[model samples]
Target: MSDIFRYIQKYQNRSLKELPFTHVDALIFAQLSYIDYRTIRNIYAKPKLKQIAHLLDLQEVEAGYLSGKDNRRLLLALAHAKRYQNIQLINETKIINEETCEQFHALTFAYKQMYYIVFEGTDTSILGWKEDLHMLVYPVVPAQQDGVRYLEQMLKHPFKKAIVVGHSKGGSIATYASLHVNKKVQRKIKAIYNFDGPALQSVESLEPIQNRYYKFVTQATFFGLFFENEENYRIVKSNERWLLQHNLYTWMIEDTNFIYLDQLDSRFYQINRKARDALLSLTHQERETFIVSLSEIFDDNQITDVAQLTNSWSQTSIMLLRSLTKVEKEKRDAIMKTVGLVVSEMLRR
Candidate 1:
């Protein structure tokens, strides 16, 4: 199965006017938000796609600082590809609130008659991951607040319509921003594309823009099923398994569209539901304590990335055990039991 790179090569010569923007195009831009665009050009000023290509060609040291593995190289190629070069970057902002452990990036682009707002997903930082967990108990996150402000600012510009798009945590923010924007701005929205992003903890605030939402997740989805999803969602086939399927690069594309699946894998759904239920079973204070403890453990070990935290399994296991000793027995037991259930379910699969 093909991915976005192959899709670009196949349709690189076609313009958005000729083919029109599709969900696949949204996914490409959503993933592109992960690139460190600030290093290439001033994000405050409009920069042509070719200008970004030039920076990448020069191997600018900061071009792809947050991009993993070959993603930077691929994004560089995409910038130069005929299909994307005509797209003009309007604005991009990356904000990190250390106190709240929130990290967000909003990128606005002008393509043809439409304006696209893309939100960046979690990077390698432990703080980023902590914020993702914080979503479990909080209805609104700092990043979501930034998203609303970004969208409201962008809507002030002259444009026919807007499309909000994001992958992973960015997807959640995109949906939140669309829902919270003023009704006048809401009327101007074309659609919201959430690719493998978590659902909102509460949909009560989403009524105004409910119909405009479109969610896409892989058959083995985990993050996408995190909360409640009242809006329509599609299940797509993936070339990866389990959590790795969360990566947009692993999502399958055929020609110009995704390889849609009729339903999500049963095991994935079972695990997701049980995980959500288990978390919800805890009190707000309990959840907060658990998340704080987990964060502290990572800090104690000086682990800033998930890979580093997981790589030294023996060390991590020892650290976790020691951390648990410091917590109240009731909270510790609840955390352990929930973890046991989740692990058992995964092992069964």
Candidate 2:
């Protein structure tokens, strides 16, 4: 399946004014937010995308969180693409607090008198999953609140229009900030694109900007289904299987757009619906305990990477089963049942 890499090669010469910006472009910037540009020389200069390619060390990228299969190509592609050469990265805010287990990254890119604020998805590190779990259970996570604050700060910059986009947990924060920002500021926002992010609340809660809110999910989405999402989302075809579809890099691309699909596979839909129900049944305290248990399990297993856990979910499931053995007998049954459903989902893959 043709994906973003091929899309970049095909459209490297086209300018934003020529073709117009699309969600696909936003998605690229969203994922690029993960790169640690601080590692690049003279980062304080805030170089354009073209300068970035020459300065970036791919060997460093190959060792970092973006090290997923075929993922390292993104920066090189963006650097060489004439369409993005003039795009200027203005500001980047990244916060990682071990005490709160908060991992947040936001990026501001200016192109043709517009600002694109991208709240990044979690890194593939173990703490990334911890933050995702925090979003799932907490009414509002610290990182999400930070995203809102970051957006507000970026708005102070001189820009005629602003667009917000994010994937995974970052997507959740982009929408959250859109809703929280004052109406005066809201009027400045051109659009908000959420890619497979879990919901903080129903879309109806933010009805004022509903028209501009666009949500996208993959055919076999797993993370996107974690929480309640009342808003309808467009589905994109993916080359990966089941939960692996959470990675937007696997999503198919056509020309300048994502390969859209009409509906999700019913099986993935039903299974994740069941999983969400089971998770919601847990009390906040229960959820907290479960998260703590997960941390212990990971530490015990010497698992430092979230991708390692996901890529070997079946083994992770077995580890979870062992972790839950000490839960109160009353909570055990419910939590165990939830674990069973997760394992079953992985087995189905």
TM per prediction: 0.88, 0.89
Q: In lDDT terms, how accurate is model 1?
A: 0.79
- Candidate 2 yields a Cα-based lDDT of 0.79
Error of 2 at 335 (Å): 4.4
Error of 1 at 42 (Å): 3.4
Off by over 4 Å in 1: 57-67, 317-349
For 1-349, candidate 1 gives per-residue lDDT tens digits of: 6987888888988878788888889988887787777765543377777566665444543444454554655656667777788687878898988789998988988876788889999988888989998998788999998998888888876656899999999999999889888877888888999998988887665667768788998997888887765547899888877777888888899988999999789876876776677667767876777678878888776788877865655565566556566556765565566556555554455
Worst 10 residues of 2 by lDDT: 63-72
RMSD of 2: 2.7
TM-score of candidate 2 on Cα atoms, chains taken together: 0.89
Query: Could you give candidate 2's per-residue lDDT for residues 4-122 as a string of tens digits?
Result: 88888988898887989887888887778777777663554677888776787777766775643344678777878899887888887788887798888888888877998898888
Q: For each candidate in the order shown, give its overall lDDT on alpha carbons.
A: 0.79, 0.79
Q: Candidate 1: give the clashing pairs.
A: none
State the lDDT at 52 in candidate 1. 67
